[model samples]
Target: MSPPRRSELEMRKELVRLRMEMQRQQLDYHAEPLRHPLRQLGHLFAPGRAARGKGTPLAFGGVLLLTLFGKRLGRFGKLARFALEVYPLVSAGLRQYRESRPPKPPQAPPKPQA
Candidate 1:
């Protein structure tokens, strides 16, 4: 047989490197400990997607309708004023709820010798 094509040789080398890299990554991931602080920090700032069945077509349609006829559907400047008033109250309620919650109790130590 003639010498192997240059493209074929390069392809085989890349495939071997990818397989080795994937195994190394998998081992590193499995050896690491799971930490919750990073996850909690992320959750604090992100808005999660709504649960299934909660985002119905009618809700989307209502948002579309509000956007399409935004000014004509409401009294002059009332909708903007209402949004301004409601957002702060909702934020305050959430803050108070988080602050007033009790701290987690400590875990018991292992039993001592008899």
Candidate 2:
């Protein structure tokens, strides 16, 4: 196969430069929303709608299986009880995350003295 010509290399470099400039412009355009006074103020308010009754079908099926097998196997009852105990922990972590402050950029690491 023939080697690429000098013009082809120049064209490729120009294409890459154009692509990078387009990305930079797009980022700046999208970032304008965060700079808006209304958007900054609105972020302070609580988010709308608490998540509830949003269980998957698998969860419902597990509950049904537990209820059905609880009498015959007894293990199902224990499994159900364990799940009940863990539910509060899962919800508490979720609630804490929902109410937590926005993440900040990481600070530079401290330089070691010579």
Give each model a TM-score: 0.25, 0.34
Quote the positional error of residue 31 for candidate 1 in Å.
0.5
lDDT of every predicted structure (CA atoms): 0.57, 0.63
Among residues 3 or more apart in sequence or in different chains, the pairs in candidate 2 whose N, CA or C atoms overlap within 3 Å are none
lDDT of 2 by residue, 21-80 (tens): 999999887566546746633532325312432444555465456544544657767878
Overall local distance difference test of candidate 1: 0.57
User: Cα miss at 41, model 1 (Å)?
Assistant: 17
TM-score of 2: 0.34
Best by TM-score: 2
Off by over 4 Å in 1: 1-6, 34-114
